[model samples]
Target chain A: MQENFIKATAFAALLSASAAVGLTGAAQADSIKIGINVPQTGFAAADGTSALIGAQLAAEQANANGGVNGKNVELVVYDDQASPKSAVPIATKLVEQDEVKIAISGSYSGATRAAAGVFQEAGVPYISAFAVHPEITRSGDYVFRTSFVGEVQGRAGAKLIGESLGKKKVTLITLKNDFGQSLANGFKEAAEQFGIEIISEYEYSIKDRQFGPIVAKVKSDAPDAIYASGYFFTAGPLVSQLRSGGIDVPVIGQEGYDSQKFIEIAGGASEGVIITTSLDRDSDSPEAKDFIAAFEEKAGYKADMVAASGHTAMKVAIAALREAGSEDPKAIRDAIAGLTLEASTGTISFNGLGEVRKDVQVQVVKDGNWHRHSIISDPDLLAPPEK
Target chain B: MLAFELLLQGLVQGSIYALIAVGLTLVYGLLRILHVAHAGLFTLGGYIGVIVTNATGSLLLALLVAMPAMGLLGIGIYRTCYQPLLSRPPYVALIASIGLFIMMEELFRLIFGPYGLSFTAPPLQDTVAVFGVNLKEAELATMIGAVVLIGGLALLTLRTRIGTASRATVTDPKMAEAFGVNIGRIRDINFFVGSALAAAAGVMVALLNNLVEPTMGSVPSYKALAIIVLGGLGDLRGTLIAALALGVIEAYGTIYLGNLLDRDAIAFAFLIAVLMLRPQGLFGRA
Candidate 1:
């Protein structure tokens, strides 16, 4: 009697499992699956949450307007924790198990670059939202980036400081990481062309909140401007220390400092600080303006570059899905490569290497908020690598 | 002028290190167990300080509330996590402490959110010029606080009955127990005082950086471990000197060797060299 009962339970479980699979199969017929990998529970969780919200908002808006080819867009999300090891399995699961048509990475360079290889190997088109590592796009033609590469942004920073701000003597404070190294390289390469002289360069780790040594050295050097590479966590303390040290010169940062939290952390010292980024808080473009409004309403905070990048990636994906007229991975890849759509971040287009091609936006802190400073649109200087 | 400024900066940084490492050294002197979770207590103190300060708009009240709260928590940790494991090998307790630290960090992340919290109105944004060196008010506060608290601790240990009891317990717990020195109570006191010092350091660091996050204690945790070892394990005075020396060395090395290595790498390289030359530590009574 007990054996019969156990057999009956097993048969019920098998029947339910098949029914669940059948339900999913039926749902999959009218929906386009897009996988998203983000660092939801790690050091980059704040940015990851913002990026996820931005992507979700984009999907919601797309569905409201009628999804690609009359099919609802479904996002299969996973937490990468900003680690390469976590991202690899996530990428594989998204591609193999879920059979997602495409994937977007709203994570740091390490995780994004690692996942890019898996997506490439699986022949599934992948888009990196904001990771700036140069190697990410090098993964394959199947991978694309919707944000400025570190080198391009770094070059833009050089131009912003050297020409726009007219600061010839500069001190470079490089964060010891891929993001910082790439930016420093681009800044150095363009510094000479822009007639800027780099007197000294100092490197610090991401864990360092204290910038006493660098501040003292930079104060002694007394450069006309300082170009530093760091995210808000590091930049906030570094800038505060620099200002409190009485070395008040123009500090140029990259997209990493493009968050309101930087202002809060730096306090009054954030005033006059500038950064080269994609999102312009004072942008007059309707697309950017609408995105800012919608995102603020949805996320309940001021939109940052990461959020804008995530939103832009999703919009590009939806646009590509529509352009391809089907869910074929190759067709989606071709459409993405050929498409040029104005996004919340900026005008989005891909180069031969799947790197983004667009002018860099410069924003400065004024009255505790980011405002437009200028635009670095030098085509020759800002042109990304084609291959 | 640059040298003077760097020196002041180093002293300020060193004072914070001393405050943090003193607690770890005291705990080791009493229990012979590495208190890796002390770093977690430091992080918790910072979170409590920030939350309180933001709510009360008074830094003093924040510090007052955080110290006792953390002191109690430290005692609780000793009773629950360390007490049971104390019977086993030292490595077992050390491993448990490390696990506790990681768990505390994750708990902080889950409770406070991944992004760090900033003081609503951080004090010491103004600079005061002294001897041609501009010092931040926050730095000055940290230095002064460290000196007073550490000095008070020194007096208490040297002049008070509890100090004698603690030293007795440290020297020979079994003998001290026979001599009517409550060894368990002394251990509790050791953890309470040590954790309170960590709390002070945590709050000061949060003020100094104007940002507090879950992983803020990680660097200081390992650095304190390196420092206690460098200063001779269980030696408070040695830890103090080692902490200051490290801060100054880091200040100088960052400018000189920064291009060659990272700030943390520079610190560890110095540690490795020191350990190789003197395995007993800088002041470990060789």
Candidate 2:
């Protein structure tokens, strides 16, 4: 018994010694560690991969340009599997173990929101790359977002449909999730102001691929347009089925349908379908053009909005680190709150609530690719909540 | 016109369910195991169909390759995973089946990449007007394929020597062995037919959606399990009817009670009602 006790004590001592060494090692290293939480597996793996590549490209570019304050920018990535259960543990590890200067979430809303709470509690500055849940920034002052919240995008969709497209009658096909519910809520809130009449609202689960009943009902309603919210996997089937069911109204979607895979899955039915998203593929801005070319070349596939958002988040973090001129977490957070820069997605600026304030970019499927439809630049209409 | 369209949509959806659940029922009838890995076979068949169709641009050729390949894989699974645990409690085999299903999903993701694959040139995009209701050609093909395949299966099981042997084994494997019926061969044939049907369902769904995803089998897997239970567990004819009935009910419920419940929730609610009213299922012999 005494020998076993001695052995246990020795093991505990060795563990503490190693942990101390690890801390010193991290402090001495000439690198600014940025924690990245992304969904490298599960249903959202595709978007996660794009986001990871985008962040990596930004880091590469920063290091190539003499690094951030002469310290190389290093990303420590963890796969959250797009689950809140996974994100909590990952965020804790990033804060307590890695002691990263800042953390970025390149995952969905649920996972990002979960991670945001952990980072906020630890007083580590956190930025959401593309996850659009409003609750994320509500976590704390340390939490910020680099993308449009679902409500902002949805409100833009209402404007695009009612005022821009000159369509007054609308039907809403909502996916029953945080992403969908928020988008639907925003669209409904702004619909009346745009003189749009909501004919009907239908809700479906994320798992549903067959929208036969919804399509039939929508056809009967025969609205001037349809506003639907779903990712590419669900959107593709929904659009195809609606078209095949002989409902040829313009289908408006949000960032969920922003992938090229949506077009490929929907086939010819994708033509004329519009969405409110971040990345403007037809942008003439040098930042957008350079980022697009670099991202596509590095990723070995077409750059997506998620990728651009991830890149933008990393660029923001680097800029903050440079502005602070030190590795202090509190200083980094203050710098991030005050920093403004041009990114591939848009002009990046944070509101009082850490929510981004930028013009929503609208794109439409034409000639088998997403092209710029119009830009919504109404400051009063697009303003994010301060508190 | 709306009613007709809903009915047509339900029938098409039901046909796909029948194609999927028939295989699950067959395996359960013979082995008394849930055979959850059957869903994995369906996903594998979908991947096979997508790969072959993309390479050859022929849906027929894709079907031909996927069916036989999945049949052989089904047999292999039985030989390696099920045969060892068959003598033990049925739960042992069930646990192994679930593990295999999860492993297969991961394998698919690792091999095919996490993103879903779409057919380069999916056929039957144009609609056909049937009774003043527009139906896609793919939907028509799905209904017809289910009819032909299920009909062929009915003939095979009702009027053949192998069918008699298979039925004998399902009733009592020891008795069938005593009567000189090759029970092992019957088991092999049972798995072969079941897996082949699952492959057909997979390819049909892939074509219908024009999307093949790794987790596509997940929803169908549990749904098929529920269907078999709703059909009184291993009653083939009852399983077929239950699948079609569930499809129709879901279509109607989706429109009527959709605001109150999701499409899947509506399905389970109907299932619960049916189970409470008739514990032996709609067509099961009580």
lDDT of 1 by residue, A277-349 (tens): 9899889899999999999999888999999999999999999999999999999999999999999888878
Q: Clash pairs of candidate 1?
A: none
Model 2's alpha-carbon lDDT is 0.89
Docking model 2 quality class: acceptable
Candidate 1 wrongly placed segments (more than 4 Å): A1-30
lDDT of 2 at A131: 91
Model 2 / residue A297 / CA error / Å = 0.9
**DockQ each:** 0.40, 0.40
lDDT of 2 by residue, A1-387 (tens): 234335545765785476446433544378889999988767788899899999999999999999999889988888898999999999999999899999999999999999999999999999999998888999999999998888888899999999999999999999999899999999999999999999999998888898887898899999999999999999999999999988899999988898888999999999999999999999999999999999889988888889999999999999999999998989999999998899999897988899888889999999999999999999888888777
